[model samples]
Target: MIKYIEKLVKKLKTSEKGQGMVEYALIIAFVAAIAIVALNNGLGQAVKDAFTGASNMVTSASNAAGTWATHKDT
Candidate 1:
């Protein structure tokens, strides 16, 4: 049983086909970790607030334009 396990380990060590895949996986994992940290540290709230402010501005502008359109001749 030990010899079989040793042979498997040796085979894994000698294999090169999966090396690039492992490197890419590591990079993706690292980026995901940074994104998670940024979102947790107020970056997420800032983005939400920015979008909300933009939406409110658009709504106000639209309502103002609609009122002017309806009251143009009055």
Candidate 2:
């Protein structure tokens, strides 16, 4: 039983079959950790605010242009 267990352990240590899966799992875990940290540190809110600001600016510009067109003949 000891020899069998040792052999199995050695085989698992030497095996490369699951190596790719392990690497992918590690990469996914690292990306998730980074995403969590970034979102938790107000980076997510900063991005949202940036987009909202831009949208508001565009809307204001559009409204101004529409008003100018309407008043062009006056």
Candidate 3:
């Protein structure tokens, strides 16, 4: 049984076909960890607030433009 395990470990160590997949898995895990940390530290809320502020500004600008167009037509 020990010999079989040793042979398996040796085979795995020498194999290269699945190396790219392993690297991608590691990168994805790292990114996930960073996202979790950022969200936990309030970065997520900050991003949300930024987007909301931008949206509000856009809406205000649109309404102002519409009001101006109505006044000009009258």
Candidate 4:
């Protein structure tokens, strides 16, 4: 049993297989953080443009309705 325990301890001390996996995890976390920040900055402008386009369409429709109502008596 003593020899078995010694072999287990030696195996634990010589392990290096997990070091590369930790490095890859850190790099992927950094890239995801950068992408989130970039998306946050651009999202506001995209929403603003969509609202502006909708407002323009509503105004044009309102004007056309008013013109038809005023000229209908002729």
Spell out the clash pairs found in candidate 4: none
Better of 1 and 4 by TM-score: 1
Provide C-alpha RMSD values for all models, in order: 2.7, 2.6, 2.2, 7.2
| TM-score (C-alpha, index-matched) for candidate 2 | 0.70
Report, for every candidate in turn, its global Cα lDDT versus the true structure.
0.98, 0.98, 0.98, 0.91
* Model 3 lDDT per residue over 1-74, tens place: 99999999999899898899999999999999999999999999999999999999999999999999999999
Relative to the true structure, candidate 4 reaches a TM of: 0.45
- Displacement of residue 5 (Cα, Å) in model 2 is 4.8
Instruction: Give the residue spans of candidate 3 off by over 4 A.
Output: 1-9
Query: Model 2: per-residue lDDT, tens digit, 1-74?
Result: 99999999999999999899999999999999999999999999999999999999999999999999999968
State model 4's lDDT.
Answer: 0.91
Per-residue lDDT tens digits of candidate 4, residues 1-74?
99999999999789887989989999999999987887699976887899999999999999999999999967
TM-scores of the models, in the order given? 0.71, 0.70, 0.84, 0.45
Clashes of each: 0, 0, 0, 0
lDDT of 2 at 25: 100
Write the candidate numbers in order of decreasing TM-score: 3, 1, 2, 4
Candidate 2: pairs in clash: none
